[model samples]
Target: MSAGLLRNSFKGAASAAPFFPTLLDQIPNAIVIFEADSQQLVYVNPAAESALDLSRKSLEGHNFHDLFGDNLQLGEMIHEVKSGQAPAQRQELLLHSLPGSIHQETIPAHVVIALMDDSDLMLMEWFPIDQQLRTERDERVTQQVEANKELMRNLAHEIKNPLGGIRGAAQLLEFELPEKGLREYTQVIIKESDRLQTLVDRLLAPHRKAHVMEYFNVHEALERVRSLVLAEFPKGLKIVRNYDTSLPDILGDREQLIQAVLNIAHNAAQALSVEIEAGVAQIELRTRVARSVTIAKQRYKLALDLDVIDNGPGIPADIRERIFFPLVSGREGGSGLGLTLAQTFVQQHQGSIACDSKPGCTHFHIQIPYRRQEKSE
Candidate 1:
């Protein structure tokens, strides 16, 4: 129906009643209507059902305070709107579901509350705060990735010329050594120089490779990593595959994607050394389809959600935030470039990777859009 007609219906004209429920269901935001007299919910949209993580039948008879907990601010605002002290209002609230609810938790939301004209009913619409936070976090990660790329490229190039000179001089010195035993000193210099060169090469690797995009199954990449890791840790660790067979093929560099996941899974296995020895280490590769996701400031109708989970001692709290930064490592003798390179590869595909760690579980979540570039526009 037209905008004017919808507003008229909200103002107590009964003509819009029959189809308005459908309209509410179509809205992306969570919305619900409440009977003012009893403070009981009368209607709920699908989005509301999903956001509240409950069914309509379970939520419809619950009182406003019950669903929203005993939040004083929310209760006061609803009272003001229902009593006609305010025509409409909005507030950012930490809403909590009742203790008896299936999932009792605090929900951060920007909520709008208003009274229905000439009707003993109230309407509420809310945008989940966590969604906004995720978008903001994605933007920050994108910015950080760009900054890191520029820094690594410049630093690697600056060290490249001197590195070659150091190796060249060491080779000349090896020939001039008076005694054969003295040659060991020059050999040490040469070996160390080669090691440094390898490190620099890795630092510049992301830029050197061409981004060869193609359509491929993501499970192909995961399976490759799973095989490699299992081959390395054959005896103790178990690799579990939780695949959504219905997932569509994604467009990207399949090799780069494999390397990205391999880096993550390899690190997880390494961290599980103690568990591996005890024969209790586990790694899970889970995939699912995510809808209506915003990644790095762009919204995608569909995206690939992949998780790499390990049951190992979590990342050290001190270095968890800096795990993606170059040269920062939690393990002794670790090069610390794995996660950095993994993040770079994912970012190249217009995707983001994140980690959440605790004492027993460390989860690496990666998301990449499923739509092709041309269709993304």
Candidate 2:
């Protein structure tokens, strides 16, 4: 994350250290402190500067409410906060004509007013609710994923030890059986043991590979998966590319990422058997740069946003939550390891994946943080 973003995120901690204006300049929210009587702006945070898309030099010493074009509700809230009639607390509403951002979309904010009683200054903080909710959601997701990994690691270890012995015993017994009927029984045992061995090996696959890191174009992996998918579903499956070609090359395991995307696309193709038959199946790979993202409680200024969207029947509602759990498959005869493996591979890159599904739509959103090439100021 940018230093400004970092400072703003920890404003409470920074407040005790000093009263430096630079501390708040890069926050992701619009904060303006003003005199109660004159309504003259005293300070504007960096987030407020960015939100309005104007410099503090241009906005300071101006009426804070005057910058808003026609947001009666927001203006009234500001007036009330300035009056100090009562503590306005937090109010949710829309703001219009934020100076330099007049042509941009309307800004929705959770506005809170605070009284700096000692200085007789009124502090108005306008936070975008979307960013607030997103940070909270990211925190929760991180916690849940950590919990899932711990449980799965323990279970995999437990299942790992027994399979080897079972397979070895079956092979030893098969060589001793001389009668054809008894040998047939031994053969069945050996085959089933081999199948279980393969299954157990897959359960441990995510941990087996050394994460080879190299700077690679993400589209290379996407295109490879696209070709592989097309080769299988040539008749009706359409793979659309919505890429941000301007994105810098990402550092990751190319093979693992290819497998991750392929598994997701393959799953979609399977679900769209009917659509593929009727020539209406469509799967999309979209990419964009995400801002102000929080992964594992760490803030990031830029992250890759890769979305795989399918217009199939969607994931079953009952199993949506467990879609990434090992052995949890919604499809008949499905091994259910694809998504789990994908999640593991992405996590290896210090990134993550999430899914949202409803009938006729399934979205797999993957986020991978860009490693900063230089130290952030």
Candidate 3:
């Protein structure tokens, strides 16, 4: 909100007596008023304390410049407002709080500086931009997953019937062949048709599973995947587990969870084949719990956070966005249905999986909400 706009809102706030502070506390954006001569904060609302990671009492007598002087750009902006160089101005800044507060990291924010009319005091408002951008990106990815679901259903149906007919005809012709050489030709057609049939069945597999819900430990699923991966690549790859044992059991299908996690681990293993040969391949399975989280635009009080991190040559940029699609594969002989199936399973449990990759690191984050079965009173 503009300084003038907030000033106007506070015009009759005194009439409300005890509720005046409450009104200022409710504003989401941080608001701070500074004295021109002393260069110290004169009034700071509750929101300012939260956004700046400093309590109002702690900030009351501290010079604004002293607290934020390390940021040269922000200092210049403050000087501009103090000298009345402009009526009001806005700029994006990287802000870090003083050493006193719990938050010690820098945050990107859009800052607004405005002077209160006929007063030496100026109001500076801080608004963080990270969460806003993340929310928008999440919405877009979720919509894309929904659209993919519809396409998979229609595409699978279109291929299944013709695939079965071709396979049946090839089988009938093989039975009628009189000589071994002629039978070999029929065998080729039958074998190829059967292969295509198996591919079609995989495409239809997600919808075929029964979602048998039960309270199951997420670590159990992780362990099952780890054991399977080790069994496949014993000599080269090393699987590390970092699990939070205190996390609550998730309401989900146990076998499906295993398949979902295995696809990701399996993909990572394939990507690290070269590194595995060199004895440098490593994958980590990490689990944690996040509170008051939002997934696919839905809010949950508690959610399970699973990270499958790999030390491999990251996903190729060309097919990164298309990696979750049914037939898109990065590997030479890969069917490319692994990640698609993984996504389908997680989404069925009202969850989301996000992937971030670079040259040395590739991380897939799977977030599923914790929905516990209530105990009998």
Give each model a TM-score: 0.76, 0.70, 0.71
Error of 2 at 202 (Å): 1.4
**What lDDT tens digits, residue by residue, belong to model 3 across residues 1-377?**
33333333344343333453456556657777766666556566655665564555566457776556578887777678777798777999888877765437688889888776636677788877786798898778767766876787788789889878987897888888777689888778778878877887898888887788899888988999999999999978999988889888889999988999999999999899899999999999998765546676676767888999999999999988778877889899899889989998998999889898989999999989998676679
Q: Pick the candidate with the highest TM-score.
A: 1
Cα deviation of 304, candidate 3, in Å: 1.2
lDDT of each prediction vs. the true structure? 0.83, 0.77, 0.79
Runs in model 2 deviating more than 4 A are 1-25, 30-90, 94-145, 373-377
Clash tally, candidates in order: 0, 2, 0
Ranking of models by TM-score: 1, 3, 2
Query: Which stretches of model 1 miss by more than 4 angstroms?
Result: 1-91, 94-106, 113-124, 130-134, 137-141, 373-377
Q: After superposition, how far is residue 142 of candidate 3 from its true place, in Å?
A: 3.1
Candidate 2 weakest ten by summed lDDT: 1-10
Give candidate 1's TM-score: 0.76
Model 3 alpha-carbon drift over 4 Å, by segment: 1-91, 95-107, 110-130, 373-377
lDDT of 1 by residue, 1-377 (tens): 34344444434454666687667766778887777777766676666765675666666447767677678888889888877788998999897765664446778899999887646777899987888777887677667767876888799899889989998998998898889999998898889989989999998998888998889999988999999999999989999999989899999999999999999999999999999999999999998776556677786767888999999999999998778988888889988889999998998898889999998999999999986656554
Please report how far candidate 2 places residue 4 from its true position, in Å.
24
Error of 2 at 281 (Å): 0.9
